[model samples]
Target: MTSTSARVGGIRKEVDAQKLGPALLIASSLVLAIRTARWPATSDEGLANVEWQKEVEHSGHIAKAMLSHLISRYPSLFLLKDVPWYVPTDEDVPE
Candidate 1:
């Protein structure tokens, strides 16, 4: 009975150590990331101004121009949501 209780206490200590270790690591990392973070400027950061410029160039029809600019600036893998350029539909003129 004494040996069994000692083993159980040891196991509980190990489990608690494991759980608290990871929790502390994650908390410290989050604090470090928040304190020393330098996020790069994305295209959408100044979206309104960019769209306004595109609108002027495209005569208030900025959809295609904005998409082209975005694709050129960012990686093709990025998924932009609610942008007019990405809707899938058949082109009116058949190839």
Candidate 2:
């Protein structure tokens, strides 16, 4: 019974460790999004900055989509270089 309990405790610790990094990342992303959303845009330049930021964010989404495609469709492209280990090879892209 103690051995079974110890095994369960070890698994719980491993799962918690795995969850911690992604949880921290999500928290940081939320903080950054909130900070950006709260940015003041009083002047004309500030408004332009906001527009530019919007465009930049759109481009970022496109870039991420393209990257996902490249990674999923052509996994061999990263054979020579170190690819992100977290990105699963079998990740499906929408048709």
Which candidate tops TM-score?
2
Residue 88 of model 2 has an lDDT of: 20
Candidate 1 structure quality by residue, lDDT tens digits, 1-95: 11222112121111222233444444445544554367444567644765445434443233344434545675332343332223223442255
**Candidate 2 per-residue C-alpha lDDT over 1-95 given as tens digits, one digit per residue, 9 for 90 to 100:** 11222111121111222333444455445545664686665667544566647755665555555545655776554333322223222233233
| Full-model lDDT, candidate 2 | 0.45
Query: Residue 52 CA error for candidate 1 (Å)?
Result: 40
TM-score of each predicted structure versus truth: 0.24, 0.34
| Residue runs of model 1 more than 4 Å from their true location after superposition | 1-15, 39-95
Model-by-model lDDT, in order?
0.40, 0.45
lDDT of model 1, residue 71? 52
Cα error, residue 73 of model 2, in Å, equals 0.5
Candidate 2 lDDT for residue 60: 53
Clashes of 1: 0
TM-score of 1: 0.24
